[model samples]
Target: MPTILVADDDANIRELVCLFLRNDGFDTVEAKDGKEALTVYTSVHIDLVVLDIMMPNMDGWALCKELRKRSPDLPLLMLTARGETWEKVKGFELGTDDYLTKPFDPLELTVRVKSLLKRYKMAFTQTIQFGSITLDRKTYKVLCGANSLVLPLKEFELLYKLSGTPGQVFTREQLIDQIWGMDYAGDDRTIDVHIKRLRERFVGTPDFCIETVRGLGYRLEIMS
Candidate 1:
């Protein structure tokens, strides 16, 4: 069973959320504020975190950023009373995998948690293969037939991320955060340049292709 960290200042809300999660078969640890949450998180093996925006000592935004820095693959969900669009945007920018407003249905929250976990599990592999190409994350090398190609760090990471979740569209902002880090100050178009280079590099390979979703983002598709 996955252990979840539930952080909220409201004692009642915290307990309620914990109760629901426990009933749903997830082991949980609770924290009253972001400071306590960070302590608990570092002390234990937490698979995911559900946090509130407002808290004394430290706010969820700071906690989220810190947590993302600690574990880029860890799942984070923002559960707060602040349901504004800007708040949601900020949460995503800070690396929250999902968001739930106050007065949320416990069932819906559980479903989203399960979904995030499933997605994470699917994308956690160290190696991926399609057709004749093999991407080895441990060695940061791509093996194609008798040839082995070593790519730049960013390019390899971007390719690994896309190939890990083939056919899943990733927004430019999402790519930037996951690949370039949340603090990256460069233009988002840098992704485009990298993508173009990747396309050129693999033009002769007929196994896979990366597609751009008009006005959305990109997805890698297996040609075979």
Candidate 2:
């Protein structure tokens, strides 16, 4: 069973979340503050975290940042009373998977959690083979034939996206929107940097070709 950590300062809110998640067949652990959340997370093998932004001892922003440093792929869903766009943006920047403002529907929360888990699978799977390279999605470890290559998260996700569609071309805009979600401001250069890094890591690998179209965008070059 999937375990979820629900951290909210308000007792009623925490109980409500726990009840809803438990009804959905998820095992839940509750925490009254961010500090308790971290402690519970360390003690138990939590599959996902639902964190409220406002709390005593520690805040959700700090917790999210710290957790991402320890486990980059740990799915985080931030709950906040502040519904401002900047707050939501900040949450994403801190590596939060999703954001829900106060007074959110229980069904929406469940749906968001399910979606994050689905993406987490794509990001943390082992032994994703494309061309001749075997990329471990979980640890971002890449292996070409018998040799292991180190690749960063952005580069790995870029390659993973391209590998899913061998002959398809993705514009820089599309890549930015898809990968960064609402985090980036449609910067084409970010896409370029990741693509360059991917090319450098898999330099001589025929299956790791990222071809650029002059008037179009970029695509995974299918090497025959």
Candidate 3:
């Protein structure tokens, strides 16, 4: 089960959030302040953080900055009583994945948490494995038994996006737009080149392979 840290100065609010998350099949750790949140953060492999903005000891903005420094991709959702537009803007500026104003329905909170975890699977989550292949997304490294390789930026992102949703074909245009950006002036062949490199790097491994979807696109296939 995934672990989550709930940080809020209000003990009641923290416990309530944890209870709802627990009911949603998640293990939750609680912290009453930003300082405690940081301490608890290191003690567990927290999948996501649901924290309030106005925390004691340290505010959410400060802690969010600190957390980003430690793990740039960690999914963070802010819970705060302040519903002002500027406050939400500041939270986003601080790199929060989602922000829920105070008095939010518990259902929405759960939905946001689930969304963040799903979206950031390659970032803060543990190593992803498909058969003998092991990928540490945080470090952009791939390991297959004794063989290992460090991928280039584009190659790493290509692999990550493909593996993100296994067996789902991503069209060449879609890959270019999403990975290379819509402003990319390069031809569609740019994606093919990156895919080719990924295949070459993992060619010797039987654990996973990129399959050509014939006239359509490509998909990451993990073999049995």
TM-score of 1: 0.69
Q: Which predicted model would earn the best lDDT?
A: 1
Work out the TM-score per prediction. Answer: 0.69, 0.63, 0.57
Q: What is the lDDT of residue 186 in candidate 3?
A: 78
The per-model lDDT (C-alpha) reads 0.87, 0.79, 0.81
CA deviation > 4 Å runs, candidate 2: 126-188, 192-224
Q: What is the lDDT of residue 149 in candidate 2?
A: 76
lDDT of 3 by residue, 137-214 (tens): 778788878778888888888887777656555677767877788799979898888888888877777778899866
**Structure candidate 1, residue pairs in collision:** none
Which window of 10 residues has the lowest lDDT sum in candidate 1? 85-94
Question: Model 2 clash tally?
Answer: 0
Candidate 3 TM-score to native: 0.57
- Using lDDT as the yardstick, the better of models 2 and 3 is 3
